[model samples]
Target: MFYWLLKYVVLGPVLKCLFRPDVTGLEHVPATGPVILACNHLSFSDSIFTPLIVKRKVTFVAKAEYFTGKGIKGWLMRQFFVGTGTIPVDRSGGKAARAALDTQLRVLLAGSIAGIYPEGTRSPDGRLYRGKTGVARLALESGAPVVPVALLNTDEIQPTGKLIPKIKRVRLRFGAPLDFCRYSGSVGDRFVERAVTDEIMYELMTLTGREYVDVYAASLKTSVEAPRPAAGAFEPLEDRAR
Candidate 1:
């Protein structure tokens, strides 16, 4: 009830007037039944704009922190996310992965759209990173078609660490639903999981035309701290002690 109220009655009208988002391939999304909208995670705003444009409610597995923040602002944020079909789940470890999958299955079984970001986290760069196998697992388990969604230019509107979004036109492109019926009953198989995830990422690369990076986006933080050059290694050392 709150989801519909916020979407149609309150916030929806305001967002539509501001972004004027250009959406393509709306017909690709199934008008009824369970469907998994697998989208690229770009910005915090991606969570907002994607659901706003889609006709159906998209249940995204949001980080647990958003729901557990402190004080009034936190309370408001929690309400906003909850109203938009955002489910809270800890993404810190493998067990949390299973929990998230279970949550998505329940949503799909109930005949609702499950929105997932296979990349697990937002891209540090614009390049598309390798997706996690959790989405593939959800699709195979629920027998829902994976619809690849490319949310274009959302990062530009509200980038990382910025509170307010700039006024800009954004676009959303939905590709045809991918059926993994051939891979049925292959759940928990590492090889099959990787294949399914790669295939989805491949289609996303083609649809979005962004550079493909085979590593996880979370590793970017580690890369920053990776073994720095020892004190100006590039500089000439005392002219080789001539």
Candidate 2:
């Protein structure tokens, strides 16, 4: 398969030699069954570097734009994503978000590890931002254990808007699996959902040791002309509904 060929024959060996990533706590990942790997989004390379280190075939939900672009470059990008098992998800909210979550749920139900950036988008400032509750929703809905994965120094390799990655050392730390069994059957409640999401974010915070902001990453990057809500006031009722 293209995935193995790239990982073993092409990109994998080369990347390992170049970056010399320090991977820790990989044993925490379940060797089998469905698992959710919730990580902070620091850079575009987060997706690339994660699979290189994790032993399992981890799949992340990537933006649909990556697959829809035109031209030869776009064609290659789409091929690479598909080969790597990246699912295309529309990042737009409302029905699009629902559809994306449905795709993620399917991946989980298939008993494979699913990677998600709870922040919903890459962190423009490298600081950990408030996480969206979609991750919790997925875990609760799928009955999967969520593992908090902290990736250090990926931003240094390929920061926002950088086409090429600088050779740099990176560290990947995977925390123990977080159980949400207590919230089982209550996933529909907004309060319980937000509470569970907050708990997962707190664990991620402890693992990453990054400065936490109460705002979502996407909201912070919105254009100045866009109407802005009061800080922390944008928390949706569905977040608490479960």
Clashes of each: 0, 7
The lDDT of each candidate is 0.85, 0.83
Where in model 1 is the C-alpha error above 4 Å?
A: 225-242
**Poorly placed runs, candidate 2 (over 4 Å):** 223-242
RMSD of each: 9.4, 7.7
**Across residues 114-134, which tens digit of lDDT does each residue of candidate 1 receive?**
999999998776668999999
On lDDT, the candidate that comes out on top is 1
- Output the lDDT of residue 216, model 2: 82
